[model samples]
Target: MGLLVFGGACLQGVGGLGFSMFCAPIALLLFPELVPGPLLALGCPLALLAGLREFKAIEWGTAGYTLVGRALGAALATAVLQVLSGPTLSVVFALLILGGVALSVQGWVVRVTPAASSAAGVASGLMGTITSAGAPPLAIALQDLQPAPLRATLGCVFFIGSVMSLLALAAAGKTDAHNLLIGVLLLPWMAAGFFASGPLARRMSRTGVRRVLLTLATFSALAVLAQGLLHSQA
Candidate 1:
């Protein structure tokens, strides 16, 4: 688990949105308790570090709009948890992410306008709340940005979104002491990955970063899909 967290953090450091994408699937399969809550907890500081690394490049306006939508989405997801099974929602959202990825590959440009950012935030909040892998939507929405700004913006958005999701999960009684403890334990690994990412992030071009973002997004959706299927079968 430490190795896994470190690897995911490294990816996120480079791509601005990969920690959950890389870790959530395996965590769900093995450490079921280290998800939506624990992982979200870990994301808070990881995101903060990334945001601070490129603070000057952050798109503050986009972050603001995304946060507003994230709040609403988190609320709705909390309510949905009362009615839906986690595996069921996971399957549904995974398909949605795959669909979004498909459209993006087909030359569909998701402009990072206020409305689009908010929409992405909604999807991100919903997915992040349930699956702990919400970066795909926002990453897709902001793919057109340059590497530094993209990373900075995503970092800011994710830090706040993770906090909101944590609160919502806590209110829904999904988070507990065990999850928090696991998150705390994983911090050192995450930090190692974050620091290691510096050199890689510096070398990546805008195009390279976009490719990494899309590829990771697709992988995350597939991982979630596999997890959902396994859970349903189990």
Candidate 2:
């Protein structure tokens, strides 16, 4: 349990770039039973806290569409994950994030506009559903914005999505007694991460943050591939 808590905090802290790419997969792998249930439940707080810490920086105008996109994306993910094998879904999602990271690092991040919001939202909904991977499209959509607003909007979208997701996952019977127990056990770690959000944001510039996120995405890709390989061998 201690290990799970630490794993959650550390993975999220380094390079998830205000996203849940690494944290969600790690949570599912380490505690499969709690995934999309307690794990998702707990993760929302981390995103919420991170976003709020940079509230002043949030690009309030475009944030709403991102939230709407996230809600739709969460719905789509819930549907897809219901039908897909866990390993397959994880690997696919990992690849998606890896691609986004690669594109960004290669200077391919397209400047986002309101017109891109709907399309990005659709993609965001689909990917985020399977992997809690809610950052890719939003990153593109918010690319033109400054770091403060960018991260802030991400925080808001994630928080909103987390709320919607919790409800959706709960309605689907993903949440249960065991899930609650895991959440309780992980409260301290979640609290600690939330507490540290301010300091974490101050530690990096936007480009630095994006680079870190891309790095994490690469690591996530390898991790997913490894899992697939291990599962195949098994």
Specify the highest-lDDT model's number. 1
Q: What digit string (tens of lDDT, one per residue) describes model 2 on residues 139-234? A: 544555556776666667667777887887778886888888888788787677655545665676777666655565576566666675676567
Instruction: Give each model's whole-structure lDDT.
Output: 0.87, 0.64
Which candidate has the highest TM-score of all?
1
lDDT of 2: 0.64
- Clashes by residue pair, model 2: 73-125, 77-129
lDDT of 1 by residue, 31-92 (tens): 87877788889999999999999999999999998888887777789899999998999999
lDDT measured at residue 130 in model 1 versus the true structure, 0 to 100: 78
Cα error, candidate 2, residue 219 (Å): 3.2
Q: Candidate 2: which stretches are off by over 4 Å? A: 3-7, 10-19, 74-96, 139-144, 221-234
